[model samples]
Target: MSTGMPAYDESGDRSRRPTATNRTAAQVNTTALLDRLRTAGPQSLSALVQHTGLSTATVNRLVDRLIDEGLVLEAGRAAPTGGRPARLVGFNARARSVLALDIGSSKIAGAVTDLEARVVRRRRSAIVPGDDARPALYFFEALADLAASLVKDAATGPAPVRAVAVSVPGVVRRDTGRVEFAPSLQWYDLPLGALLEERLGLPVRVANDVNLLALAELRHGAARGRRDVLTIALGTGVGASLVLGGGLYAGSGGAAGEIGYTLLGRESLSTPWPGFGDLESRVGTAGMLARMRERTDALPDGFGPEDFLGLARSGDEAATAVLAEVVDDLSLTIGNAATLLNPELVVLGGGFGRAAADLLVPAVRRRLQGRIPLLPAITGAELEEAQLIGAAELAIDLAAAAPSPPT
Candidate 1:
């Protein structure tokens, strides 16, 4: 578990031992410098000092330290600056790799990404999650197998694997790394991060799928410019991720955006909703399809949510009516959320959500405009496999945060 960096040396100028506070500051400053180098590309010692706002002496020492750890490399000499060419140092994002997994109830999509979060290769496998009657061993073994296989495939030596990030369709405590529940997967109180770390010999970070998707969007998609945004996943189950003040806001219990559980209407105000919330129960994939089924028996067999949206788009009468109802439910839920949060943007995401976004966004916007005083601009999620991409980005951050490889 070397983190592909030299060992962290606490003893700087042994003559005067550094205090714990000083060591912490040094670590933070070093990370800041490395981040600057990673993002700004190659720079010479003097330029690094200017870019990082660190003293020339500090930048020189840190650069030399990173160079020793293989995290920094001499790209070449800089342009002649009235004197001898200065050596330019750059971050070596390829010095280490990461494994990012997007684990859905039916499938596990994995990829090996570089420290910069660029996908190197991808793989996926079908999954049948175990239930209460079944042991958890099967699920775990399958996951471990997928991680091992992904790492093996990418072990061609461009970079060494450093950490892992996983995306789960459930409630996960960000601080504890324990899964609270996954209705579809039937996984509860699962210590996914610890288990994976023990098995893979690397650090693991696990998060809810919707949150990760939001992270992906903010990092590399439509939420880029917005300071306050909501990323709602409209899939098998409804879930949302919140970004407030330019930061991923995981509430105290990591359930900040569980909007799916909101009460649907006055009729069910006191009714028991054990699993799927009223909003989700009414507007989720199953709910919309159920509406279609109730609409008519003349429709084609084996039709699904996607087909329902397609029919609605094509102006099928029954499907359009059903779509209207679905839109109403979604509009109510999204409008309420917008009224409360007043986010600058609302990003619709997930399989069903992304596909139906074209139809949903405008309708929701118009409804909210009349109902609420302020309305946020709504948009569909951009980027393929956004959850996985978010996982990759998290894995990269985990790797990057590792104590600058032990110089």
Candidate 2:
């Protein structure tokens, strides 16, 4: 039987050769074993072998390497089955910390977390929308300071921060960690990751905010155990993240899930926010508020999206009408996406999405039922600080992949 592996040719380009096949396989096996240990709590070498289908020797070697790197710990032995007790191994979740930053349109938030992405400490600061003098630099400095303060305050003095992960409200170039565009934050073509790494003196990973939320949901929230999930964030603006085949699918340009830019109607150059797409311009917070203001002068002072939703829920006719229009637009957008992606689950998230879920979900569900053959379960986000949690998750993955230091 043929192995079905790529053939090696002396004249062919060296890069085309499957030189790292064995190495890749080994890495995958190691990750699988580690995941099992992390999830199953603790297991003996025999149990790990049984769970991962790897040879006992391979499991032992990987576990030993992980133990040396402080990523795995040899817990006390398990209870004796017949003759001898087996030594159990477990993931070392407190080995190192990670710093996460959520760079939102309105504010910047930071968190320090353990290996399992549990927040130990958090800090947040508001960002002035139209600051012309090095706004990004100032925010980066603040985040670095926040991280340092958290580390200093930890019970364990100056615990090592393995990596820094940032969630930005924009399209990011995954390869170079550049912010290609952020309409809400007014950032464009910025080398944000490198700048943050310089300020914090640590490895940095940056991703789109909605993408991070999707990752959080996939790992710890509503989308757990499900692949082909779509998470829609409705807040100051509309955004989405797509998780396909149990992985975050950043497209060729790292903008695969930028559903906010999907055109819903005719383009309008005269719109105040030029690039905000039709779907977002209609159903987003600003759009909803504008629609409500147009229909009713009775809106309470300092009215916001949540306030309007509350009023709508209480049977206020004008507020209800505004919400109905917003829901209809959201349904159209979501229905179009569902028709294309056919995801298993659709998660509603972000400030407005979570707040209006009670009203929006049922309405969207009804609309989808008529259009689509199979409707996905729509739900709100389970995690409160999803962007921060997801950033920590990305940091944890980066830390796990970093090379172990020399003994």
Candidate 3:
């Protein structure tokens, strides 16, 4: 997990001409300078040169470009000791903004954020289960409405909307940004990115919800400063994400960490339930509800996923038994992943995961102690809007990399 503050490498030859290579490298390195300002506030040009260890000429070139790009603005002067005051530069975070959305199975949530990926405004709409069964056009039209609403007020803000990034509950095609399959949403091969970009007249990035969540944890939450991690999301569904080499690893097909499909036993291998995977069927919300109904009928109907965890926390015998089973499944999954990826930490997130984290983290640690040779540090997510905020950060990156800033 990267905290998104990679070290500034001043290895470029100071005397190199501004060729295509130099321009490309400068564009990428410019972000490091801006990120520093984002975290450390304004600084003198001399200070930035000292901090980055780049030659004064190189820093001056980069700062001039950033000013032209509207990402940095002159912020008065710093006091000097008996010499001319140093010119200051600061990150202009509000000069540009992006929209982020998470279209989960249970609801749709979105936010508008500035360049630093801080949420300036947010909106969420609850979705009843099975609502996706409606016609795709109907569902999407409504979804687009909500997305538009998130940015409709952008005109009045300090920044202009530069781009939009969305996370969907599905396997997305890397090249096309198409939703290959989303069983929960009944969306298949949907050109979501292009459609939204066409509608909004802005750049759009679409990615897997879990992948975004993992990025969220890596950049803005509990897994910060870690280089490798496994973040599991236990909500209405069960899924996981991998952060390797301090970045997200979307496998060859953009489906690397689909742990929900893992088979726990030999019998599970023969089962052919494609909609919900084997591990997911056992540990997901439906699975817990099923186990509760099997063990005891004390709870009334219409009980939700969080209700089950809450009851278990209250020491209800049947709920506790079901929770123990969930913990066992999760421990097995985490132990196996740690053995392979050797992640430095493990993060538990999502609605159910967040709700049960206080109760689950300790039990999981005890369960994996002797089972796995190398145990990892376990923690809950620090951000409730991990997916949405992660998308904002990614959108900001995309905007910064564009040849020209948004009009």
What is the C-alpha lDDT profile of model 2 across 107-178, one tens digit per residue?
788888888888778888886636558766565566567766765565364447778888999989876678
Tell me which residue pairs clash in candidate 1. 5-405, 5-406, 6-405, 6-406, 6-407, 7-406, 7-407, 8-406
Clashes of 2: 0
Candidate 2: lDDT of 33?
A: 66
Q: Candidate 3's residue-wise lDDT over 330-377, tens digit each?
A: 888889899988999999998778778998899999999988888999
The global C-alpha lDDT for each of the candidates, from Candidate 1 onward, is 0.78, 0.76, 0.77
What lDDT tens digits, residue by residue, belong to model 1 across residues 178-237?
888876777888888888888887788888888889888876788875668889998889
Q: What range of 10 consecutive residues in model 1 has the weakest lDDT sum? A: 6-15
Candidate 2: lDDT over CA atoms? Answer: 0.76
Indicate the worst ten consecutive residues by lDDT in candidate 3: 7-16
- My TM-score estimates for the predictions, one after another, are 0.87, 0.87, 0.87
Q: How many Å off is the CA of 356 in candidate 3?
A: 0.4
Best candidate, lDDT:
1
Q: Residue-pair clashes per candidate, as listed?
A: 8, 0, 1
With a 3 Å backbone cut-off (N, CA, C), the pairs that clash in candidate 2 are none
